[model samples]
Target chain A: AQSVTQLDSQVPVFEEAPVELRCNYSSSVSVYLFWYVQYPNQGLQLLLKYLSGSTLVKGINGFEAEFNKSQTSFHLRKPSVHISDTAEYFCAVSVSGTYKYIFGTGTRLKVLA
Target chain B: GAGVSQSPRYKVAKRGQDVALRCDPISGHVSLFWYQQALGQGPEFLTYFQNEAQLDKSGLPSDRFFAERPEGSVSTLKIQRTQQEDSAVYLCASSFLAGAGELFFGEGSRLTVL
Candidate 1:
């Protein structure tokens, strides 16, 4: 079984400021990592993913995440945030060989104007 | 349409009543999944289907929860004798394949048991 841990339950940042949301995972086998954003009353949208290759994965909306295998971390970052960036973010992991996904508790990002 | 769709966006059920939620995956998608999201928490896997076969259902909380993908495109999740604990958002997602691919999600069906 695989599990994900998001250290922060909520984060507040001023507009145009940089922010980071931390995530870590535990799995016995290799895994794929992903970040998803969900707006109010809406479905989740993919932010980025780390399947293989480069450790730094760029996503939409000026967001990026770094996959650190040794540390078992995939932290999401944005150099500058806007008020519209406020949303709930989730970090998930799927086993390398399976379709089942395990998601973190989630981090609520509030980008204040 | 373009994205996954779920029916009965909001449902209110009395305790001990049964309820069913529907999901329509993207055309040609070979894999589908069901998850439960409690307030302030991330989605938790419930079951998965590959084509018409149910590949995994280990995450289902109890035998009272049942899911089926009859024709491989539309899936249904049925809960029998619903309890207050069953009140949550039921999310449906689909992917082209199983691994290393992105999954598209639906708005979800919110079920409230009172």
Candidate 2:
């Protein structure tokens, strides 16, 4: 079975500051990793995905994540954030042959002004 | 539609009442998925459909939860004898390809069981 763990339940950072949300996963087979963002009263939007090539993946809204196989981590990072960037971030893993995804609990990002 | 859309954005149902949620996937999308998101939690997979075929449904929590995508474009998830534990936001997503691709999600249908 595959599982995902988000080290932090909540992340607070001052405006214009850098932030990182930690995510780790455990799976027996090859997997595809993804980060999604959800604003208040909205569905999740794909931030970035790592299918093949490019361990460092860039996503919308100036967000990026690096897939570190050795560490089993895919941490999302932003050099700077805005108040609008506050949202719930999720890390998900989908195994090679499976059509479903296993998601971590989630990390609430609070971009303080 | 331009994106995945779900109907009845807000639904309040009695504990024992049955509820049906609908999802309209993006045009030409071949894969559709259902997920449940509890407050302060990430979305959990409920089922998957490749066109009219339900390729996977192992994520469904119980027999009370039923989903179908008969025509492949529109999908419906029906919950019978709903319980308070079932109160959560049900999200619908669609993708152009299967196995590996980004999914487009709808705002979701928030079901509140009382």
Candidate 3:
């Protein structure tokens, strides 16, 4: 079985400050990791994905995530955040053959102005 | 128009009532998925379809929850005897690749069973 864990439920950060959202997964086999962002009353949008190589993956809105195999973590980061960056972030995991994706509970990022 | 589209943006139903939510995947997308998201929680898988073939439905919570993609492009999720616990945002997503590719999601249909 595969599962994703997002330790933070809510993270408040000031505008123009850096932010990081942590995500950890447990899987016996190799897995693909992804980060998704969902705005208020909107559908989830893919931020970045780690399929094979290049542990560091960049995504839209200046967001990036690094896949750490040893630690089983894929943490998302941003150099600086704006009020518009406030949204719910989700971490998902899936295997190569089985496309079933398991997602973390979520991390609500509140960017203060 | 370019992304996955879902119908009935919001649906409020009394307990035991039946409801149907529809999803129109992006044109040419071969894979479609359904997920249920509770308030302040991540989306949980409900079912999946490749074209018109329903491959996996292991995540469905109960027998009352049923989903079908008759023509391979449009899908409908029918809930029989809706319960209060069924209240959640039902999301529909589609992808061009057969396996796990980038998924395009719809705004989702918010269901509130009272």
- Each model's fnat? 0.77, 0.71, 0.69
How far residue B32's Cα lies from its native spot in candidate 3, in Å, is 0.5
lDDT of 1 at A7: 92
Strongest candidate by DockQ: 1
For candidate 1, write residues B13-53 as lDDT tens digits.
99999999999999999999999999999998899999989
Two-chain DockQ for model 2: 0.77
Q: Comparing chain B with the reference, what is the TM-score for each candidate?
A: 0.99, 0.98, 0.97
Residue A65 local lDDT, model 3: 95
Number of the predicted model whose lDDT against the real structure is largest: 1
What tens-digit string does per-residue lDDT give for candidate 2 at B32-84? 99999999888989999999999899889999999999898999999999999
Model 2 residue B87 lDDT?
Answer: 99
User: What is the TM-score of each predicted model, taking all chains together?
Assistant: 0.98, 0.97, 0.98
Candidate 3 at A11: error in angstroms?
0.4
Q: Score the docking of each candidate (DockQ).
A: 0.84, 0.77, 0.76
What's the lDDT of the predicted structure labeled candidate 1?
A: 0.95
Candidate 1 collision pairs: none
Alpha carbon lDDT at B27, candidate 3? 99
Clash tally for model 1: 0
